[model samples]
Target: MTDFLNILLRFFHFSSLLLLTGCLTYLMLLTPAGYRNRLEIRLSPALRSSAGVALFSAIALFALQTVMMSGEITALSQPDIWSAVAGTRFGHAWLPEMLLAAVSFMLLRAGGEAARYLLLVTLILQLILTAMTGHAAMHDGWRGVAGEVSQSLHVLAAAFWCGGLYPLLLLMQQGQRDPQDNTAVLTMMKFSRYGHWAVALVILSGVSNTLLISGIPRHFSFWLTGVLVKSVLVAGMVMLALLNRYWLVPRFRQSPAESRRRFIRLTQAEMGLALGAIAVVSLFATLSPG
Candidate 1:
């Protein structure tokens, strides 16, 4: 059962991550644009529905993971008074997930950007605080707070760019259904700009995280490996983003149909990288790297 539980946690963690990508992408980028009549015409309702389900599954799976990770797997079988989703470490984490979950439901039902923005804020808060409860922050002094913030930013930024790739790729695959949709390129630029911001913070925060850990020269092997892995992922994402913005995106803008297709492929690839990074993150979260 312990093995099964581990498997369950891993599966749910990855699934929630995929959903989280959509949730963050939709709320931060797509939601507002969608409200302003900016979405492509061929983005079929089916695609939107799948995104919603993905987001919903992410929250539910996360809640379950929280239950298990919080060391409450056995408690889950206890009476609702103690074992409930609202009464454990899972509950603390669930607060934001639950709120964001509601936001996704509303977005689907009401169909607007306001819901998206609200959801984005909630997701950010949840993610930010989520890292704080971990050993990285709670175990250290004042400096740890900054480390925590960076780690959270790192994750959030990764989700924004990485998760956004799915929908972006999907949009691209739609084949420039709207020849005049400049928003596609605009969104690409937006992600590039955001990627720059994520990178800056990632570097600064990474330094702080290094300080908390045994330094590069000291633990050059395993300790540095953790940070190095994340750095490589961030670097790759940044390069892809740069190419998308300056190179492919410009060429794409000149040709609507082709640009959409390119964006879709890029988004798919971005998501794959983001998932790989997160898988590494999950292991790091479970271990004491130093």
Candidate 2:
């Protein structure tokens, strides 16, 4: 029960955090100034909801971890137990995570470019804190430092790729409604131009994280199987992205409506695949590397 709850909460936390980071990154970097204001207004509610989910999940996960560590259901009411857990490495990370999530949620209420930039900082910092407690924490010294950095890059790249899809989907939908809106094409082109780099970084950082955490697994373990599945899912996402960029996207001028529909459908598929990969990671993260 505890294990299942842990994985479930992790999925929710990661999904929300990734979406928050990805949305903001896309708006600030890939989105054109003409469309940025409108999209920001549209996505503000979602951003706040993501922050709220992240904050709640972080607290729940921390409480669950305390129970797991102390092996007592009553640990929830124990101040000493809470303090002890807070002093540990995971606690150290969670403290910052909680603070960041709270600040992010509050900041989302304010208007202007400054708050958005601050929110982005908080999201990225939370990602780094998250990286510190996972498999990377298993190692010590410089190797551990390398692992966390690589993992941070992996997640950051993924946030840009996986999280940016929502805004892109919205843009495309807008384009479909009013064929004259060129922002969709401009944003899509920008995403494609820079998205290739994000995808490349995700693959490279993933491999680096694997190598740093542990050399190639010689035995068939749960961890190995999970990694393989995640790789295949990511590969599928890449192929779909390429098809959209090279094939469907080109037909936009020749057949705008048909192409837009196809693009949206495929984008939805990519999102499904991305969430599946995240779920797999959340599940496997609970397993022992060895």
Candidate 3:
């Protein structure tokens, strides 16, 4: 039951991060400066809501973790559990994350150019802090710092690519209304460049994480199986991304309507694969490391 609760909380935590990161990435990187008004009208509410959810999930996860560590659900109300939270590595890592989430939620709700940029910085730091208490933190000395950096990069890259998908899909949907509008296509083209870089970082950091946590071994293991499944899902997402970049985007110039439809479909497919990958990672987090 404790394990079940842990995975459940982890799912919410990861999902919230994806939403928050994706929304911020879209606003700061993909959306055009001239489109700021459109973004405020169309995307601000969603971003604010995601920020709220992210903050709530962070607090809930911290509380649940305290109880889990104490080995009793009732520990939720116990002083000892709170004390443990104050004294542990996980708690130390989570405290800054929770605070940043709170600040981000407030800043997103406030809604201005400076606030949005500040929210992006806060989210980036929060993502980095999240890596400090995970499997990476289990290592010793310099190896531990390397693990933390690798895992941080891995999370940031994954968030940028996978999280950006929902906003991209939404943009595609909007483009379907005016198939001739090159705005969405142009934005996607720009994003594809970033996506390529992000994918490379994710792969390199993933390899580093594996090496740091569980060096290549000949035997199969449950954790390794989870890793394999995650890798496959990520590969599927990349294939869909390539299809959108090379096949669908080019088709937009020739057949805007058809390309818009296909782009939406492909983006949704990629989003599904990303969600599956996140679920697999959450499950793996509950398992013993390979």
Candidate 4:
């Protein structure tokens, strides 16, 4: 069914988006934080490979979605479809994503303090741009630009909060890969502080976004259900973030063993929830702006 397939695409899109967001956080935030902790990160060969692969995967998926959505409207198909991509609104929207992804790849491959700093800045920018492409910023002219700014802040913050999940999960799975190794613990502390800052920004941006999108005049009934779903999911994400900061980080810093296991379990769940939220976001983006 076209409907089912559309939903499925959205599901995959969201999953991919969440993973991409997390990757951004990992590459930008978690990795650097590890260095700051004075723990020599094993930037193992596999880790470097993943950096390239992840960048390519995110770019490919986003491009695919743009082309597919544009294909139905235009007559472009197959090899010619790329031109359709270059000429469409979706294509225009995709330009920044492609550019950022390119930068991400280049920086990731370079691998140094300078490259890491650039990567973090780029990740923060991409998250903001991604949010701007959504319905919330589709209106409001000058105000809309401000909306994008707030939105960028919101997305960057959320990505940092949620994206840290994978890196933390990996650390947990290895379970005291080095108990005395203060690197993981130090990294965790940095992220804990960063996560709190992100939460505050998320709350502020959320209020701004809600006010902009929903008002007395525009009764956006179509989006009501999806918005509610997003709200609940965001609440859950905040809870997980809190747990990571208040409960897990301190425990892990101390009980290294139990902390590792609990962190892994929670992160796995967090990943699923993030994916589900992405699905909702993709669907919401597709709907007509009411």
Best by TM-score: 2
State the lDDT of candidate 3 residue by residue for 68-166, as single tens digits: 787778988888788888688988889888999999888877757887888888988988988887887688899999999999999999889987887
Name model 1 segments beyond 4 Å from true.
Answer: 1-74, 79-113, 213-217, 220-226, 253-263
In the order shown, the candidates' Cα RMSDs to the true structure are 4.7, 1.0, 1.4, 4.4
Per-structure clash totals for the candidates: 3, 0, 0, 1
Q: What shift in Å separates residue 112 of candidate 3 from its native position after superposition? A: 1.2
> For candidate 4, which ten residues in a row score worst on lDDT?
37-46
The list of candidate 3 runs beyond 4 A from truth reads none
lDDT of each: 0.57, 0.91, 0.83, 0.62
lDDT of 2 by residue, 1-290 (tens): 89999999999999999999999998988888777999998887888789889999998999998899998889999999999999999998998888888898888787888888888999999888899989976799999889988999999989999999999999999999999999989998998898999999999998888778768767878887888899999999999999999999989999999999999999999999999999999999999877
Clashing pairs in 2: none
The digit string of per-residue lDDT tens for model 1 on 94-155 reads: 56655665565555455555765665565566566556544456456666766677668665
lDDT of 4 at 17: 38
What is the C-alpha lDDT profile of model 4 across 1-290, one tens digit per residue? 43444555545533433444555555555655545323224333433454455456456655555445555634334546666565755556566766876786677667567766776666555565566567667766776787777777776666666666666665555446666656555566667777778778977887787667664435656676786788788788777767766787777647768877777677677777776776776677677646
Measured against the true structure, the TM-scores of the candidates, in listed sequence, are: 0.70, 0.98, 0.96, 0.74
In model 3, which range of ten residues has the least summed lDDT? 36-45
- Which 10-residue window in model 1 sums to the lowest lDDT? 35-44
Better of 1 and 2 by lDDT: 2
